[model samples]
Target: MARDIADDGVIDGLRAAATADFETARAMPPEVYTSDRFLALESEHIFSKEWYCVGRSSALPAPGDYLTCDLAGQPIMVIRDNDGNLRAQSNVCLHRMSTLLQGRGNAGRIVCPYHAWTYNLDGSLRGAPAMSRNSGFCKDSYRLPQVRCEEWLGWAFVSLNPDAQPVASRLGALEQMIAGYDMTRYSEAFFEEHVWDTNWKVLAENFMESYHLPVCHAGTIGGLSKLDEMICPPGHDAFNYHTILKDESLRIACAHPSNDRLSGDDRRMTYLIAIYPSLLITLTPGYFWYLSLLPKGPGQVHIRFGGGMSDDFKGDADAAENFRQLKALLDDVNIEDRGCTEKVFRGLSSPLAQAGHLSHLERPNYDFARYLLDRIETGQGAV
Candidate 1:
């Protein structure tokens, strides 16, 4: 039998500790980072219910191109079918439970390696060798079960819950705020997946705030930001955002130098947003990068991260050299962040661990904690 999450008093205690005021709110307790029961509850209530970016639409541009991943314990595949439609389907073979796809590529048809059953790119059954011998076997009745998929701002997002709200409806005014970036034209430039040895929320919180920049990223991008310039304005029910104001102090050309149409702040600022449960994005005038996390356990997080450049950068003659330099800097930043969060995870397991007070700089993280409390305790939906 599986352990019960409802029986744990820790959930109630976490609800009580969460507060609206960032200055007074305590950080989420240690058990939420170490308990398997809490992780299971999160998978059902949060991961399966939220609209998350799987990757950019540019990745699988042609028909039959696909990407496969395990989401909230569901083996699923996303493909661009011959009909020029992006679709998500259960990766499980119709005949048995054998997974139909491995790593991503263009497949003429999804063929089950376990048996001879085959499925079309649109998820219809194409063939089942030797199965016609069975009486009453109807091939039309068995097609890959379809999952909900939607596209937004050049990215493809998937949700296991049929009743979940569309990603655009939930984003509210975020589109308007970021309209000048024109994210629809962005293409995949770099992509990689890795498992980090830290709690998923721990990494999510890192991306949600700029408080650690001075110490964690000092010699890199941090030096360009000022403590007073950071702002944590009120967030919507579906997302939280803050700005990292940059000055001319930047040592490297991490962002595009300019875009004539973008407003002044849009060219100079980097906006970091956490869209409930697990999608995190860093948007700037020239380029963008995103991190979408999947919790394997309380201690392991699977991360899919990639970045793309806007037309301003892509159109540059030196774009290739610029991307190489940008990726090197990004690789260094990721190394620094990974080290810091893994250390924090280890600290959470200490006997004396406690939910410390939050800082004004950590307001976005406070919003994230509130989102978690609302979903798990009050049943407040992720707008």
Candidate 2:
């Protein structure tokens, strides 16, 4: 019942099909979803080299506020320092490699619960208890390893690789694409995380297209979207997106009433994108939500899903009520996606499983397939 992802041929076959037209493009080979070897390679070449969005900067709005997380299995922490700047660093205690913190909280000094080692918000060592006894111990010389961190439009991102470039360089176009929204002013309305029983790509491909809106999402958010209106444009080197129009009939599902000032498609359309590696975003005039995926294994993924409200909506008197309603809708959509992706994970192992033709609606998935193949074959995207 195990998959053979060890052979290079599994990836070679995918590279061979990378140039096909979107309509003629085939799904990536099944093993790509269930192979441990391939997942390891992806961690090394893609995740480690990319700047991953951990959460919105507003989540840690004050000095000493911090959130602990893992990116590509690299344990790290994101914190707002005394100077009001955000910092990311290895969350492992240097004394004994024990984890330094868990979940989120505000602390003036990060104290390792395991051994009582203390570190400043900037990652410099403050106290080592008995560590001075070591022959070469220099408390001043020991500090937690710092990871690269940056923020754009109110979201904070961290990278395990020292050479990773700023996310803005690769995402400037996407930033401008939704410029009217002024994402920075938005504040997180809701946040959630789930460990799904599906491959990371399975969930990624799910978000990159609305082809499933009419089927998988049914009766909910999908009710307002039609595959015909989904514009799956060519993907950029860093991401892919498609625009979907909301059916005018559903009052609540339509753009927020307060967003009347937005013009044209901004009033009627929603755009969703999958930033290379694992960030998935759904942007609308009034609000936006994102899912940051981390592959846990061949059959599991860690998903962080949350949404924020535009300045207009955030200041709306009924913002609380509206956020409550929005969370309910997204939760239903998550249930639907979970069911579908988990089942697909099971199917990737079916003897009948084979690459299939891509639907025009599945263009993002096709582009994602190529994006993955390009990296796996040549490691062309690290910086």
lDDT of 1 by residue, 1-383 (tens): 12224425667656656764555788888887787878877887888877767888889989999999888889999999999999999999878789989878999899999986999998889999997689989988888989999998887899998989888888858888878767785667988998999999999999988989989998677877877899988777899999876774441223455556665565677788887778888876666788989998888899999986666777678878767876887888999999999999888867777778878888887787778877776443423
lDDT winner among the candidates? Answer: 2
Cα lDDT tens digits for candidate 2, 212-315: 88889876877788777789998988999999887766443346666655677668678897888888888776668999989888888988888866667656
TM-score of each: 0.94, 0.95
Worst 10 residues of 2 by lDDT: 249-258
Q: What is the lDDT of residue 344 in candidate 2?
A: 89
In model 1, how large is the Cα lDDT of residue 377? 65
Error of 2 at 276 (Å): 0.9
